[model samples]
Target: ACKKILISQRYRLQAMSLIHESLSYSTTYEKVDMSQYIKGIANNIQKYTHHTIVLDLEPCVLGMSDAMNLGLFLNEAISNASEHAYAKEVKGRIEVSLKYREEQCVLRIKDFGRGFDTNRSSHSLGLVLMEDISNFFNEGNMMIDFEEGTEIVFSFTQKKNT
Candidate 1:
């Protein structure tokens, strides 16, 4: 029972951390270079993984609020991949790509690893927080593909400046 309590408390703390990260940034809309932001996240994740991670990004303008939220989401996703996607002795590959299409931005994170069961709820706090953050974006949609490793795609239209 104590162990379960500790685990529950840990999850609560993680959820609070993600919420604080999202709220720390202002919701004001402004032009942001998303490629730079995503690249930075990929680098951070790379530091912890034995896997080789590659990024392919398109130049695009995004609102500061959206960018901040997306950053946190990507951080969670990439961190999960880095920590859980590969065995210690075996190196894997993670690919992150961003593109703009039809007035929407699509971000994809793919990893070559032993895929997980998507039909069951993920026990990771990071994943739960990611789902929460994705919902914060306007019309944000997230998809996970476990067919050939794990592929997560997040897509949302940028807000129009009045």
Candidate 2:
């Protein structure tokens, strides 16, 4: 129970840190450079997991709310991958990519470790929260593939600026 509480606190801290970093780098405080935001997240996760994280991020900007929601979604997904995907003594590789094209964004997180049963995790709080976050995006959709490891793909259309 204590360990679970510590992990929960750590996750909250990570979310706060990401928000602070995003706001610090924004000029208008309404938009966030997602590439930079994701890099910061990847760096933090890498340090904690000591796993190889390869990133392929395209430069993209998103509204503050969308960025925050997506960042939280990412935090949950990546944290899940790091915790559940690998063995204790094995250093695994995780790949993250964010691409924006034709007014749509696709974010992919893949881990080269043993995958878990998605059905068993469907009721987990982390997965439930991630699903909720994805709903905030315009036409947002999330898919998880367990073959060859666990790969989570989330895509959404960007909201048009009025």
Candidate 3:
């Protein structure tokens, strides 16, 4: 009983951390096409897995980081999650969401399946590569939530003047 309670609490904390990190950017906003933008993201992720793919990208101009930054961010995180989080014949789901704030863009990539340990996960090259991207945004938002599933998000400044 105690173990179950601890696990539940851990999940809850992770969820809050993911949501919070995705929203902490203080910057400007611009336009982004969800489908086209996802192409770069999908390619990066696919390279890391040999399984089927599923994607649901919201249709709208998501205020996002520069095209390059956004691409790299999704590529590394999704690929890492795909490789480490999925199992044989146990398909996977990747969800990408972009929320436009008046002055910034919040990007989120979530996966379905058992999540990972953020602390121990940092040693992995995927997470390291993802962290390396952090220097680009002094105030950017990024997070990895490890609960029932995994959710990673990054908030970045708008690419163009609004």
Candidate 4:
């Protein structure tokens, strides 16, 4: 329970940090450069977890609310991978990518660790939150696969302003 609490707190801090960093970078404070924002989050995760984070983000901008929600989603997904994907003291690498083209966005997070049973009936709060965040996107969809480690993909339409 203590470990879980700590992890939860860490995830919250990460989300807050993303928001703070976004505000710090924008004069209008209404838009966020998602590529840079995600890189920041990746740095934080790598620093504390000692896991290598490989990013392939294309430059994308989003409204503050969309950026925050997506940042939280990434935080939860990566936190879960850090905690459950690999054994303790086992250094692992996680891959993250964001591609936006023609008003379509695709985000992928993949980890090479012991995979989980996707058919399980358990629905943790983190998973629920991620799903909710994905839904906030236009025509958003989230897909999870655990064939060889776990891979999560979120596809949605980028907002008009972005």
- Compute each candidate's TM-score over C-alphas: 0.76, 0.91, 0.63, 0.91
Count: clashes, candidate 3: 3
**lDDT top scorer:** 2
Compose the digit string of candidate 2's lDDT tens values, residues 1-162. 687557756875787588777788667788788888888887777777867889999888888889888888888888888888899898888899998878889999999899987679889888898899999989999999989999999999985342
Model 3 CA RMSD to the hidden true structure, in angstroms: 12.4
The weakest ten consecutive residues by lDDT in model 2 span 4-13
The local distance difference test score of each candidate is: 0.72, 0.85, 0.59, 0.84
Ranking of all candidate structures by their lDDT, best first: 2, 4, 1, 3
Residues forming the 10-long window of minimal summed lDDT in candidate 1: 11-20
Runs of candidate 4 with Cα error greater than 4 angstroms are: 119-121, 159-162
Q: Which candidate tops TM-score?
A: 2
In model 3, residue pairs whose N, Cα or C atoms come closer than 3 Å (at least 3 residues apart or on different chains), thus clashing, are 27-103, 28-103, 141-155
Model 3 C-alpha lDDT per residue in residues 1-162, reported as the tens digit of each score: 586445334433443333233334323334445455565446434554565455655443444554445556666666656656777667777766666665566778787777877678778766665677765774776777777688887876654333
lDDT of 4 by residue, 12-79 (tens): 78777778877886887888888888888878877778777899998898888888888888888888
TM value for model 3: 0.63
